[model samples]
Target: MTGEVAGGRVPLPQRTAEARLIVVARAKRAEDYDRVLDVLVEAGIRSIELTLTTPGTFERLPALTDRYGASVDLGVGTVTSEAELARAIGAGARYIVTPVTSAALVAQAREAAVPIVPGGLTPTELFASWSAGASAVKIFPAGQVGASYLKDLRGPFPDLVAVPSGGVDLDGAAAWLAAGAAAVSVGGPLLGDAFAGGDLAALGTRAEAFVSLCARTAH
Candidate 1:
């Protein structure tokens, strides 16, 4: 990957390499993101992905981007189709993430100069996404494969840029980074119950903890 991403922006992979973290949120409703995101932003999270599974995300995304776009890389994830990708870009998604390895999506992102991180679980899938020009490939269900899975992958794909997502806790996040993961994309484990009206203070604490942990392990 190039040092500068398309559109002359810092590549998402570089941001993740430096921050070593990407916090993903899948709120039931779009309005719930405001408070949840405030806590994350305050905790110094630079990469944040809001999924399309949440209702009203496309409609409310523009405002969210307007509010936090400059300070953070506000992205859209769980993208499944060309229409959604178009809508995400129109709504100001700084980066695009998919649940599957798709070269088409990566090309689309390039057309808009938006970085794309496509998800895949197996080694072949992961390499395919990276080869297709994705900023990085997400290791979905990384917990099943464990942290060492990334290390093993590096044996064959020494320069592979990966972000382990799904079922990762604080320790698992550290483990992934230790194994050469570009970043750890954490969701439920890090979010806890923040969107379920859980404690924002507690959420902040967790976020801060992950941020500190990643910073300490960052290469």
Candidate 2:
């Protein structure tokens, strides 16, 4: 599906197709978040997910879009309400991600023609989200289930595009991809305690590593 925006039309599937890794950034301060984002973008990580939990995220969305939207497919995550969904779209988010499967939100995204990746852990929830027209289904806290879970899920629903988020590090990212995950969403592992006064350079190196891993193992 396509939706018209300031830049032009946005094709939902195409947007999801281009993202191999989505960096989830949540910082107490916007400046720190920006710093990490710069490092990630410089390391060739083009997709970013700014969580609503971050302070000033909604207020800063427009500026973020203006500055990096051209090169990065910026999106909003941890969304749970229609209001948040609306605000994200207005902020020019290329995609929407939720922590749980919300059929209503999925329908709203479908209407707007924006890609939505709703979180689900069970087969029922995942299938429901996909059936509701979500561009992809995100398996939250995937570390607990591991790559084996994803591979098993594909047995019943081979067509489902599964994205594993939370607790996913560079070491397991390729394994998830090999298990048939459409893409992987990484957070603290890639950030490397940067928000806790760690070195941004370390984060940059980690970003490069993740990007290279994705390249080598992309499905």
| Residues 57-104 of candidate 1: C-alpha lDDT, one tens digit per residue | 999888987888777787889998988998898888878889998878
TM-score of the candidate numbered 2?
0.92
lDDT of each: 0.85, 0.84
Clashes of 1: 0
lDDT of 2 by residue, 1-219 (tens): 235432322334443456589889988866666767778889988888999998888888888878887788888999999999998988888899999989899888877888889999999999999888788899988988999998898888988888899999988898899888888999988987888888888888999999899888865
Q: Where does model 1 exceed 4 Å of error?
A: 1-10, 13-17
What TM-score against the true fold does each predicted structure earn? 0.93, 0.92
